[model samples]
Target chain A: MKVALDAMGGDHAPAVNIGGAKEALELYPSIEKIFLVGDEDAIRAECQKQGLSTTSPRIAIVHAPEVIGMAEPGAKTVRRKKQSSINVAMDLVKAGEADAFVSAGNTGAAVASATIKLRLIEGVDRAGIASGLPNEHGICHLLDAGANPEAKPEHLLVYAIMGSAFARHVLGVKHPKVGLMSNGEEDEKGTTFTKETFALLKGFADSGKAPFDFVGNVEGHDLFETQLDVVLCDGFTGNVVLKSCEATAKAMFKWLKKELTANAVRMIGAKIAKGAFVAVKERASAESYGGSPLLGVNGVVIIAHGGSTAVAVRNAIRVGMETVQHRVNPHIEATLQDVKR
Target chain B: MKVALDAMGGDHAPAVNIGGAKEALELYPSIEKIFLVGDEDAIRAECQKQGLSTTSPRIAIVHAPEVIGMAEPGAKTVRRKKQSSINVAMDLVKAGEADAFVSAGNTGAAVASATIKLRLIEGVDRAGIASGLPNEHGICHLLDAGANPEAKPEHLLVYAIMGSAFARHVLGVKHPKVGLMSNGEEDEKGTTFTKETFALLKGFADSGKAPFDFVGNVEGHDLFETQLDVVLCDGFTGNVVLKSCEATAKAMFKWLKKELTANAVRMIGAKIAKGAFVAVKERASAESYGGSPLLGVNGVVIIAHGGSTAVAVRNAIRVGMETVQHRVNPHIEATLQDVKR
Candidate 1:
């Protein structure tokens, strides 16, 4: 597979992205080439500093001088900066020069660039970000995690289809259990929008044509407690819920650490239990999953966290390759074609 | 202070309710009377079984013949079951016989009964539940925690005033710092509803007449990271964030325990560090705060968790007494009256 990565994306920029590209080249034999899209001078300097070969046949630098700021307005910045690395990288995917596009840059800009450049797949109303959350059973993907904020019930219906496809094909869930995010588990417990979405999903589930089992409604706690594969909600709610969970976990660990070091006895105990803490942290960290895929786009697009480390960037590239190898987009298209609606 | 307890409201029912009432009477010398609103026979039986004096004149059993099921529809059930314990307890407050009403029962039913019976306070359009979260600086109250789901921008403005009054008077903040919960901390990072609410709040803050310092937009992480006193949002978002945090905390502790007990060395360390865990758990426990106050109502209404233990019930009663003693409602009224808009 060929990939075009935004070399100047994320907080650490060229160094981490270059390091990730080198690691991906070493680990994955399937990668035929990687096009580093960014300022040529900076990419070369970072590549040299990292001890990576600048003349490697598998690596190529596509000079894109402009760089989008992390906090810049999404679509506007993408439109204004025609030579920006994110847009240039997306263009390569549109031209089929690369199999997938990866970025740890401005999330909004990455999303906008992908949608504008690649367009939407047939029968898809909007693209969504399928963010991964670690649950008891495994990983549960929450769709529309700040991609489509103002969505209709029909949009959510489309998200369920896309999310289910992503879970089954890329995430490898045999029969993905999809749920509508609501305030309560009861069928009647939701806002007007969720209620309407619930009706559509329930109807589709009753038709016996759905690829996944429809779990009527799920609460916020169900994200961790239930064995759900995919949970669907509008971007506004999904984003807030995802961030809240992250913050809570961070605060819990911080508090635990402070208390554990309060006395010598507890400190010694903490030393012995250090491995346990490290194990749990690695399991819970976003770096494990690497990136959230921007689903429903015509091409593969993976958006990594802006503060990604070199290891996280490597994993993100792996996720991008997996999406391509698994042919997740094709599965979504085929599944949508079977729907009567 | 006289308090009305919904003895038949919670999952534990009359048992925990009675046990809590006895404890509250012993703990607080200021409590003049406790009216246990439930079936007269059931309350008397539980009180007697718990070795409590029934004829001491301090504890009264009010006969509430009907009971509302936990899963019953909220407003409809409140209207249908006129003699339900929740309604009876709310009626006691509406009639000026009780200074506060406390329920560890169906949150929806309690909110409905309180809103219908006590009505909204002056200049308030809707009632909000100010749910507390233990943060780095102390506690940050999230407003509209499931009360006003479909809130307008003006309603959120009112929530800001009420939440500020709650934080300053009831939560003991000398000067409360309030924030609008959004997906990002930027000036333009929320849904249209939140953006409009931001404009209104900004206007109030700029006028130099607002009691609290409006801190613009804050993300979900700010709930734990920042020294915020109150964070305002619609009930739907607030409820989801709160439940997600609760679930995350539970999952973290469960995973920590499993990992810590995996080996002899770690198990020994876990035993030595058990005290630190207990201290942090207590610091983060909902039972410590006891209950969430349904603000913007005419009377003090505290809603405890449905599965509250006896200790939680006792704490709920204590919160009720504090809300009354602090004159929270009157302070809210006085603050709202000063606003020109």
Candidate 2:
């Protein structure tokens, strides 16, 4: 699969991006070619510094001088910076030059660029960011992680379909159990928006025409515990919930570390169980999953974290390639078409 | 202070409630009386079984013949069950016989009974549930924990005031720092509802007229860190966020325990550091905080979890007494009156 990666995206771009690209090529034989979309000189220098052959047939340079900043307004930046790496990379996908596009840059810019360049699949209202979060049962896909702040009830239905499609093929959940994020687990819980969407989805879930099992309602805490395959919510709640959990985990670990080192006896015990702590951290971290895919969009678009490391970037590229191989967009198009009926 | 205890509210009912009342009486010399509100026979039996003096001047039995089930509708149940323990306890507070009311029962019923009978304070539109969540930096109060599903910007101002008052007096947080819960830290990063609230809180926070330090936009992750005293959000978000964090912690501990006991070496390591784990659990558990106070009402109302144990019940009553002693309602009233002027 051919992929166009925004070379100057993330906080530590060029170097980390180049390193990740090289690693991706080495690890995945399916990645036929990668168009390193950014400034030609910077890309080549970083490629050489990272000990990768600049002339390698598998890697190509597509010079794009402009760079969309992480904090820049997304839609405006995408519209203004025609030559930005994010836009240029997406252009490659639009032109059928690459099967997928990856960026760890401005999330908004990435979404806007993909929406503008690749456009949305038929019957799709808006694209959603579907992030794979670590849960007790395994990974659960959280949609609208921050793509659309204000969404209509029908929009959530679209998210559910797209998320379920992504979970089934890309994430490999056989029968994804979909849950609507709400204040409570009761059937009547949630805002009017959720109530309307719940009614539609509940009916659809029972029709057997739906792609997954419909677990009526799920609260914030239920996200990690229940064996749910896909958790759907508006971008605002999803973003808030994701970050809140992240902050909680970070604080807990900080507290744990402080307590563990408070005394020599605790320190000795901590040392012995150091491996277990590391294991837990790894299992709980977002680094393991890398970027989330912007589902319902026409092309494969993966938006990585702004502070992504080389490992995270590599995994993002891997995700992009896997998404293309699974033909998620086509499946989503088919589902949306069915939904429209 | 005189406090009314709803003896038939929670899962364990009369036993835990009676045990908690006794414990509270022993722990706080200031507690003059506890009117155990429930079926007279059941309360007497539980009090006797728990080795409590029924005829003691400090402990009184208030007969409440009916009981509201956990799943009953909030307003309907409160109105229909006039003799329910929760209603009777709230009535005691309304009648000036009890300084505060504590319930380890249906949260909706508690909130409904408190709102309907005790009524809202001057200049307050609605009541809010201010839950004290155990964070790394002592405790942070999350308001509208599950009370108001839809809140106007003005309502949030009241929540911020009420929550700050509870924080400063009962929580002993001096010059409490308050944060408006949003999806992002930036001023512009929130739903339209949150945006307006942010602007108002931002001004109030700066005007120094507000009781708490108005720390602008905080994400869910900010709950345990940042030394923020009170985090204000609509009840829907607050409840979902609170429960989500709880679920995440519980699931993480479960996973940690499983991994630590998977092998002999890991099991030995876990055994050595059991104290540290126990200490960490204690720090994070809700039992340490007791119940959340339903603020903005005319009287002090603390609602414990429906599944609260004896220790939790004891803690809830203690919170109620402390709230009364602190005179949080008057302070909230002053803040609101000042805001209006």
Candidate 3:
């Protein structure tokens, strides 16, 4: 499938974006074309510096001069900067020129651009960002990680359906077990919103109308231990948990490094154990899973991290292509159809 | 100050409870007495096993025949088991016989007992648990960590007040900065509940009637890096964040250990780095904070972890004594009066 990548986005900018597109081209022959949507001059120079020629049959440059800085208001920027890289790239997908849109830009901008340009899929309450988090069993699809903070019970129900669809098609989980994120594990637990959502999910899952398995209420820590495929929550709670996990991991590693290098003996030992640490870090890194997908949109959109490296950007493209190849939108639409009735 | 210790509570039970009380007696000479409120026989045996005699003038065994199981329903158990260790100890505080009560038992039972017996201080809407979380800064106090899930905006307003009081008097901050936890740092970044709470908090702080500094909005990660004195949210959000952080830490350590011990070289390195790891673990541990205080209650009640060890139990007693000394409840009552009007 063809992909439109926002080349002027992320901290590393056009260089990593261009480098990533080139690597994706080499790795995935299935990626027919990558439209480098950014400032024309910057994209060309980065391609040249990286020893890549945009003249290649598979690589193409699409000029969109304006760049949305990371800190700018999302909806405002998208509206004002009509020719911004993010807006233009999304427009490409909306026009059916590209199967998917990928960006390591501002998440809010990405969500806004997609929501406004592509619009939400029919029967979907709101779009959500589904993130793949590492767990004991494998990876758990957590949504909406940040897309819609002011969400209702129905929005969460739609997230459950879309997240399950992604887990089934993209993550290759058969009969994925979906869970509602709550403070307690009991059925009687959760706020009024969650309680209402839980009843709907439970009824639907029990009736065998849905494709995924339903695990009633999963606590926060259960995300890592419970070998469930999909974990669902409102965007606000999901975002809080997601970032809290991120902060905790970052703090722990910092503490670990400080402790390991405190004394000479530990430093020597750290050398010996460097490989293991590297392996662990790679396994736990977000770059491995690429960007979170903005599900329930009319088209596929992958929202990568702002600090994404070349590999991350490449992986994001891979995720985007896979999402398109798996026909995630079609599947999500079909799954949500069952809920609408 | 006199403290009532629930000797039959927690996983390690009577032994640790007795041991902790004895240690607290030696460490804090201001502790006038400790009422070991539990089964008389079990308390005496544990005291004798730990080579301590109940005959000591400062130590006394208050016979409480009933025990509340961890899995028992909280409100019902508290009402039914009136002579339970938790209830009896809370009674010690209620009857003006003990300055404070500490328990490493069922959290629900602790909350219920504190609320029912001690009651909300004066005009407070509800009682909240103020938990100390270890972060980049020394500590960040997170309130309503697991108390009232159905918290209204006014309840949160009171939480903000009580949290600020605890931070200033107990934590010794000159002017505590209180933050409302949200999905984003922006003013308009939260659900309807949080939006209402945010508006109320902002108005109170801006009017200069609020004692603490109000930081508009804080994300989950900001808990560590921001160095803000107190973070306030509804209990559901706080509990989810709290447990998610705990789970992430546990999972990371498990992952690290698996990686570090995968081979002999790493194992040797781990041994060399053991000291640093221990130091980091101790620094990051919840045990160091004793236990979360059930804030806004009329009497001091420290809720220790159910899996608390002897040191944690001792620390809980220390916290209880400190809370009583600081007169946290009275201060909370006074601070909240500004908003109650």
Candidate 4:
């Protein structure tokens, strides 16, 4: 499979991208080629600095002059920076030159570029970003992480469909348990938007045509506590929950470290228990998941965190490859046909 | 100050309520009396079982025959179960028989009863729940936590006023730093609701009549990372973020404990580091905060967690006393008079 890496998109930029490409080539036999789309001179320098051979046939440099700033507005930046690395990488997928496009840059830009370039799959109203978070049972994909903030009830119904398809084909859940995010667990508890969404989802589930079981309304704690496969919510709510969980985890670890190093007794104990901490941290780290797939798009497009490391970038490429190999988009289109909302 | 406790509310019910009342009477000399509103037989039996003296002048039990179940609907139940503990407690505040009302009951029931019985403070269009969460600097109150799910732009404007008053007068911050909870930090990035709210807050800030500094649009991560006093959002978003943060912290601690006790060496280290873990746990506990204030009501009303412990109930009564002693409601009315949207 051919993959296009957004070499200039991310905090570490060309360095991590080049390193990731090298690692992907070494690790995956399925990767036929990796097109590094960025400024040729910068990519070449980073490859040389990182001791990655540019003469390898698996590695190719596709020079693109423009680079989108991390904090720039999403759709606007993508349109303005026509020759940017993100745009070029996405174009590779659009032209069928690459099987997937992966970026650890501005999420808005990637979503906009992918939606505009690749277009939504037929029968799909909107493309939602299904971001995965580790839970007790397994990963719970939070659909519409940030793609459609001003989503309607129909949009969420579609998200339920798309999220279920992703869970079944990609995450390997036999019968995904889906839920609607709300303030309360009761059926009548939600905003006007969510209440309308609830009725629609409940109707679909009652029809006996739902690919996944609709678990009704779920509270925030259910995300981590319950045995849920996909939790459906508007992009606005999903984004806040996602970021809040991330920040809380980060804050807890920070405080734990501070407390564990408060004195000699704790310091020694922390040293002895270092392996336990390392194991838990790795288990909880987003780096393990690598990236969130922008589902409902016509092709595979994965979005990693802005501050992604080389390891994270490599894992993102792997996620992109898996989405393609598993044929998640085609599965979604097929599922959508069986259940029309 | 005289305070009313909803003894029949919460997961633990009369047991925790009676125990908490006993502790509060012992701890606060400023608390003159506590009215325990619930079934007379149940309250008396629990008090006797816990060895609490019902003959004490500071303790009084008011009979409330009906009880509103934890899972019951809010407004409807509050009206139907007229003799419920939550209603009777709110009536105590309304009749000037108690200085404050405190409950570890159904949040929706408490909010409904308080708004209906005690009424809204003049110039307050709607009431909001300001739920506090501990952060790096201090506590950051999330306004409209669950009170007004379908909040308008003007409703959030009232939340800003009420939240600022709570932070300044009760939380004791000199100048509260308030932020609008959105998906991004950019001023233009938010749903239509949040954007409308942003404009109202920005206008209020620009007029130089605002008690707090408006920090434009803030993402979920900023709730912990930044030095924010209050974050304004619609009830639906605020509730989800609040619960998500709580759940994430709990999950992390649970994982850490499991990993730490996996082996004998790590178990020994964990035993030695137990103090550090205990300190962090207490620091991150909702029991420490006791309860969330249902702001903008006619009187001081506090809503504790449904799963609150005895310590939490005691702290909630303490919070009620502090709010009454601090004259938070009058201060809010005064602040609202100074700024009109």
> What DockQ does each prediction reach against the true complex?
0.78, 0.65, 0.72, 0.81
Q: Model 2, residue B164: displacement in angstroms? A: 1.9
- Per-residue error for B26 in candidate 1, Å, reads 2.6
lDDT of 4 by residue, A188-291 (tens): 89989999999999998999998889999998788888999889899999998999998888888888999999999998899888888998888778888888
| Local accuracy by lDDT, each model | 0.90, 0.86, 0.87, 0.90
Deviation in Å, model 2, residue B8 alpha carbon: 2.4
lDDT of 4: 0.90
lDDT of 2 by residue, B113-190 (tens): 999999999988989998887766778888889899788899999888888888888778889888889877877778
- DockQ result, candidate 1: 0.78
Clash pairs, model 3 backbone: none
| Candidate 2 per-residue lDDT over residues A1-341, each given as its tens digit | 89999999999998879988999999999998999999999999998899988788898999998998877778888899999999899999999999989999989899898888888888888889998888778789888899997877788888888888888898788898899998777787788888998998988878878888889889766678789978888888788778878777776787778878878877887787778888888877777898899988889999898878888899999999989899888888888777667
Q: Residue by residue across B151-257, what tens digits does model 4's lDDT show?
A: 89998888888888888888899999999999989988998899999999999899999898999999777777789989999999988888889899988888999
Model 1 per-residue lDDT tens digits across residues B1-341: 99999999788998989999999999999999999999999999999999989998899889999999888888889999999999999999999999999998888899899989999998988899988898789889899898877889988888888888878887788888999998778888889899999999999899998899999999888998899989999988888888888888888888888899899999888888888888778776777887889998899999987778888899999989989999999999998888855
Write the residue-wise lDDT of candidate 3 on A30-111 in tens digits.
9989999999999989999998877888888999979998877787889999999999999999999999999998788889
Give fnat, all candidates.
0.71, 0.58, 0.77, 0.77
The better-scoring model by lDDT among 3 and 4 is: 4
lDDT: worst 10-residue window of model 4 chain B: B332-341
Order of candidates by DockQ, top first? 4, 1, 3, 2
Model 2: residue A225 alpha-carbon error in angstroms: 2.0
